[model samples]
Target: MKTVAAIALYSFREAVRNKILYSILFFAILLILLSVVLGSASVHQDSRFLLDIGLFSINLFGDIIAIFLGITSVFQEIERKTLYNVLSKPIDRATYFLGKFGGIAMTLAVQLLLMAAALSATLLLRGGSVDLQLLGAFWLTYVESVMIASFALFCGSFSTPYVSGFITLGVWLIGRLVQELAAFLDKVEEPASRHLLQGIVALAPDLNFFTITTQLTYGYPVGLAYFGAVTLYGLGYIVVAMGAAIFIFRRRDFI
Candidate 1:
């Protein structure tokens, strides 16, 4: 546990020093601020527009940081031959993998907190009130980002960084549309194709379930039961992905 914590802290420090991470965070905050300006153009719907833009900025930028950093975390270590030194140490592959993931997750949590704070401040300035529902929406967004980070880690475990990034992005895109794809599959006349599509859809993540920005914006009722279910789903996927990554990393031969 101590070793894992050390590695996690190392990863956190490394990620903090990444210029790209700062650049992306800067732009995300800039967009959140720009939302205020854009929202002001609307007469009565300014608050709604501002909330929408702020939430979207957080979600979009958070995902970008997760995917980029997650894909490269282990791969960069291997490419630079730093992984060999780490592996030669007392730490096992599973602990190392978990530490790396925990570090990235920690980084995402910090960035998400900042963005959520910005959103709340923006809302307060606009005469809009912050409530539990709004915070719940941000929590779900963080859940989605965590799931994406795990997916990226899994991809990076067995493939080159570029390929991992592509596959991670593909998974995200497909996951977002999994429900629509399932509906389309049901309409297909061909039985074989329908079954194939069904199998694919079953394996894909249900990201649509995490999206509650519209409900948050409109002040719609998002039940606690539903939120708990989606949070569990995201956490389940993260566990599965991390498990696979550890298994793969243990067996991988860095020649």
Candidate 2:
């Protein structure tokens, strides 16, 4: 456990030092700040506009960061031939994978908070309170990003970083549009084809479960129980995905 923690801290430090991460975070905060100007254009709904823009900025860039970290974390190690040395230590492959994922998750959570805080601060400037719905929405998005991170790590375990990033982003897009895919499922008349599509959708992460944008936008209520459920779901998905990544990593011949 200490070994994993050590590796995780190392990874967190390494990731935070990446110039690209800071660049992306800067843009994300910039977009949120831009909301202040854009929000003013709308008459009497500056808060709502800011909310919309801020949420969009955080969620979009958060996913990008998640994918970026997952793709680069282990791949960089292998590329620099450091993975061989790391694996040569007493730690098993599973420990290394878990540590990497933990570090990625930690880095993402911190970045999410930074973005979320920027949004909240902007909202306060616009006379909007940092309400529960907004927080819930942000939490859900982070949960969604965490799932994507785990999935990208799993992909990077077997494929090149380019392929892993592409596949991860593709899956994320499909997952986000899961509602549209479900509506299309009703259009299919053939049972076999419909079932196949259904299976694919079922196997895919239900990102819609984490979406509360409409509710947040409209000032609808979101309960604590729902937040608990969503949090648990995200944690569960990460565990399963990390297990698969470890399974694949263990089988790889890194010689």
Name the candidate that leads on lDDT: 1
Q: After superposition, how far is residue 109 of candidate 1 from its true place, in Å?
A: 0.6
Q: Model 2: how far is 247 from its true place, Å?
A: 0.6
lDDT of 2 by residue, 2-94 (tens): 989989999999999999999999999999999899889899988888888888889899999999999999999999998988999988999
Off by over 4 Å in 2: 190-192
Report the lDDT of model 2 for residue 55: 88
**Residue range 1-255, candidate 1, lDDT tens digits:** 998898889999888889999899999999989988998898899889988898889998999999998999999999999999999988789999999998898899998999889889989988998988888888999999989999999999999889999999999999988989988985898989988888879999988788788897788989999889999999999999999999999999987
Q: Which stretches of candidate 1 lie over 4 Å from their true place?
A: none
Candidate 1: count the clashes.
0
> Clashes in each model (backbone N, CA, C under 3 Å)?
0, 0
TM accuracy, model 1: 0.96
The estimated TM-scores of all candidates read 0.96, 0.96
User: For residue 199, what is the lDDT in candidate 1?
Assistant: 88
Q: What is the C-alpha RMSD of each candidate to the true structure, in Å?
A: 1.3, 1.3
